[model samples]
Target: MSVLDQKQTHKYSMKPESAPVFKNLSSDLPSGLVVFLVALPLCLGISLASGAPLLAGIIAGVVGGLVVSVLSGSQLSVSGPAAGLTVIVLNGIAKVETFQAFQLAVVLAGILQLVLGFLKAGIIGHYFPSGVIKGMLAAIGLTLILKQIPHFLGADKDFFGEMEFFQFDGRNTFSEMAYAFQHIEKGALIIGVLSLLLIMGWDNPRLKRFAFFKFVPSALIAVLVALGLNYFFKLNLPALTVGQEHLVQLPQMDTWQKLVNQLSLPDWRALQNPDVYILAVTIAIIASLETLLSVEAVDRIDPLKRVTPTNRELKAQGVGNFISGMLGGLPMTAVIVRSSANINAGGKTKASAFTHGVLLLFSVLFLSPFLNQIPLSALAAILLVVGFKLTKPSLYLNQFKLGWEQFIPFFVTVVAILFTDLLVGISIGLAIGVFFILKANYKTPYFFHTEKHKQGEVIRLQLSENVTFLNKASILLTLHHLPDNTEVIVDGSKSTFIDYDVLDAIQSFKVNAKERNIRVHLQDIPEVISTNAH
Candidate 1:
C-alpha cells in the first residue's frame, strides 16, 4: 500500500477495547452529537408518518439508545424509530381503534420478540446472501439521497423519515422532487448548500490535523451554523428567511407538568381486544426481522467487521420496545441512517448511542425551542453526505466483479427497494438469491465418470453425501439418456440418506433399461417395490 493509503487506514482503524463506557469520550461525544442531530428529526418525522403522537418517536429514540444500547451485543449499532415500521404502526393504530390500544400491542410485541430471542430465531439472519445485504445498504443510501433532496431544497411537504416510493402525500418519490423544485425556500437552500460544502470540507485530511476541527463533528456545526444563518436572514434578509414549517418542530414542553402529560401509558384494557393480539404478533415478527437485517447490514459496514450476537440484539430490542410501549413510545429497530451517521462521525462504542439518547432526553426537557430553530435543510445536507458514501460507485463495481450470481441479486434488491418498500424489496431479493442457489445445485448431486470395459464402456454415477427429492430429476435424466449397450452402476455408498422419491426413480429406470440395451446395477441403493401387485 502507498504511504497515503497506510495513513488513511491507520486513521480510521481502531482496536476494539473493553474499556469503560466513557473511555472513548472524545470520539463518542462528537459522534453522539452528530447522531443526535440526525436522529432528532427522524424520530419526530417517523412519528408524524406513523400517525402517532410526535413524542412517541422521541420516546422510541430514547429507549433505543439508552435501553437497547445497554443490552445489545453490538457496539456500534444505534437504534430508533425505523421508517420500515411506519406503515405497520399507522395501520395498527387504525385497526386497534386507539393509540393506547396500539401501545398495548407494542408491549405484547416486545414479549414476543423476547420469546423469539430465547428460541434462537435470530439464526435466520446469518443466512442472508451477502449480495442481498449489500443491496440493502446501497438501496438505503439511494433512498436517503432521493428522500433528502426535497428537504435539502427546503420543501417540507413530505415527512423527513418517509422512505417509500409511494408517499402519504399522494406523491411518489420522484414526483415529490419535481414538486420541491417549484417551491424552494431561498433561506433553507442557502443554508443547505453551505452546510453541505462545510461538511464535505471538514472530511478533508488537512482538517484532521487541527484539534478543534477534529474534535467537533461537522454535522453539529452545520446545524448550528444553519440556525444562525436563518436568524440572520430573519433580521436582515426577510425574503430569504426560512419559515417555521422548514425548521425543526420539536413539541414544546415548557414545564415539568407538560412533559408528564405527554407521557401516555399503555391501556391494559386493550388486552381484551383480539385485534391487539394480531397486531402484536405482526409487530413482533416484522420488528424482529428488521432488527436482524439492520444489525447484519451494520456489521457489514463496521470498520472492525465485528459480529453481533443476533439473539442478544433481539432480546435487547424486545426490552427496548417494552419500555417504549409502556411509556407511550413508538416501536423501534436498529435504524440504518442514524447508525450510519454515528459511524461516519467516528463513534467508537455504544456510549455514543447512549449519549445520543441522553441528549434527546435532555433536549426535549431543556432545548426544545433551541432545537426548533435548526433548519431541516442542514440535517438533509448531512444525510446526503452519508448517502453518497454508502452508495459510492466503487461499491457497484466491486459487486459486479463477483459475477452474476452476486450482481443480479444485488441489482434486483436495489431496484426492488427503490420501487417498493424495505421489507418487500428484501423479500424479493432473497427469493432471487434462493433461485440462483437452487439452480446451481440442481445438477450437482452426483459425480459421473466412465471407464472402458471388456464388453463396452461403463458409466459410474456416484451419489453425493446425501441425496434428496431435489436431486431426483438429475438422477433420472442421467439414467434415461445412458448410451445403448453400455453398462452403468448407480452408487449410493457415500449417501447417508437418500429420499424415497429418488429411490423410486432409480427402480423405474432399471425396469426400462433392458429395452434400451443398457445394463444397470445399483450399489448400496435401497430398492423401491411397486405398490400395485398383479
Candidate 2:
C-alpha cells in the first residue's frame, strides 16, 4: 500500500501478571532493606530541609510505603517525600501562618488529586513524546551523579535528595561541589570512599555464589561496615572518626507517648482561610505532576516493562497525601531515587515497597540509635552507583546513533536539567521534541509526483488522508511554484479531511493558473470561493 493508503495499526501486548507480594520474599526482602536504608536519611533530610519537624518526613515515608503501595497498581514504583516540593512546602508554611495550616492544605491537595483521577486527567502523561521521556531519564541520572559527589566526599553542606541546580545554601550544584572538595572531612571521606568501593565490588558474580552475598544487599553491608569502621576510628584513629554531624539523624522519639506528642494535627479551621485553599491548589497541581513524571520514568526503567494504570496511580497518591496530612506528614510523590533503588536491588513485587515501609516504622520505634550510627557517606555511595547506572556511557552512545532527531533533545535535556531543575528541563525538552514533530509533519502530509506526457509534462499532487493547518504552508508553496505550460492534477480522493485554508489555497491557485498557461484539474477536491476574490 502507498504511504497515504496505509491504515494505522496498534499492537496490543498483554500486561504480565504480578507475582504475589510474599511469593518473591527472597529477593523482595533484601531489596526492601536496601530501599529502607536509602530512604531513612532522605526522609530525615528532606523534612529538615523543608523547615518541618523530622517526624513529618518519616510519616510521609510510612504512608507512601504502606498505604500507597497497597492501593497502587504499580508493583515497582516507590513513593515518598520529594525534594522538588521542599521550597513550596517551606514557603507554604510561612504563608499559612502555621505548620498546622499547611497540613490542612496537604489534606485538601489529596482531595483534588482524587478528583483529577476520576476525571481521567492522567491521560495527559501519554502525550509526552518518547524522546522527551528518555531525555528526562538521562537528565535525572546525570543530576544524581553531580549532586551526590559532595556527600561522597564527606561534605554534608547540602541536604540529601536536593535535585535543583541552585541550592538553598546560596551555592549552585557546581559551587557546592567545589566547596565540599575544599573542606573534605578526612573521617567522612574515608567512610564515603571505602563505602562506595565496597558496594561497587559487592556485585561480582564470584561473590554472588556465596549465600552471604546472595541474601544480603550490598547497601546494607556497606552501611554496617562503615559503622564498624567509624567506631574503630573513634577508638584508634580519633582524627578519622565519622562525626555525629555526618550520620543519619532521626528525631529521638524513644517512647510511644513521645512519638504521639510529636505528631501534629492539621487545623480544620484553616479550611476557611483563603491562603490555605490557595496553597492546597498549588500542592495538588505540583504533587500530581511530580508523581506523574516519576511514574512515567519508572515504567521506562522497569525490566518487565509493565505499564501502570496512570489514573489508578493518581488515586493512590491522593489517598497517601490525605492520610499523611491527617497524621502531620510532608507531601509525597513516587520518588525516582527510591523507586530506582528498589528496582536495582532486585525487588520483584509491591511487597518490597511495603517491606521498606515496615522497616521505616520499625526503625523509628526500636532501631533509631543503630540507624543513626549509619554514615551518610554510605548512602551517598549507594546513590552514586544508582546514578552511574542511569547515565551510563553506553546510553549516550546509543542516543547519538539514533540520529539528531533523538539525540538533540536527549542532549539538550541532560544539559538543561543539570543547569536548571527537573520540571523546567522537561518542558524545554518537550518544546524541542514538538518542533521536530511539526517539521516532520510539514514534509510528509502529501505525495508529489511528476510525469512526462506526449503533449506536455504533468504534475500530480496527492493529499494524505488527513491535512491540518500545519500543512497549509507546504501546500501553498507547491501551488505557487508550479511550472508554466504544464498540466497539473490536484487529487484528494483518499483525503478524509482537509483544512479550510488548504482548500482556499487550492481554489485560489486554480483561478490564477490560466495566467501562466497552466491547466489545473481537480479530482474529488472541494471547490470554494477563492480568498483572493474578495
Residue lDDT tens for model 1, 133-222: 999999999999999999999985778878999999899999999999998988889999999999999888999999999899999888
Candidate 2, pairs of clashing residues:
none
Query: Which residues of candidate 1, in runs, are more than 4 Å off?
Result: 1-22, 255-257, 443-455, 466-477, 492-534
Quality of model 2 by C-alpha lDDT: 0.85
User: Which numbered prediction scores highest in lDDT against the true structure?
Assistant: 1
How big is the positional error of residue 249 in model 1, measured in Å on the Cα after superposition? 0.8
RMSD of each: 6.0, 4.7
When summed lDDT is taken over every stretch of 10 residues in candidate 1, the lowest stretch is: 525-534
Error of 1 at 229 (Å): 0.7
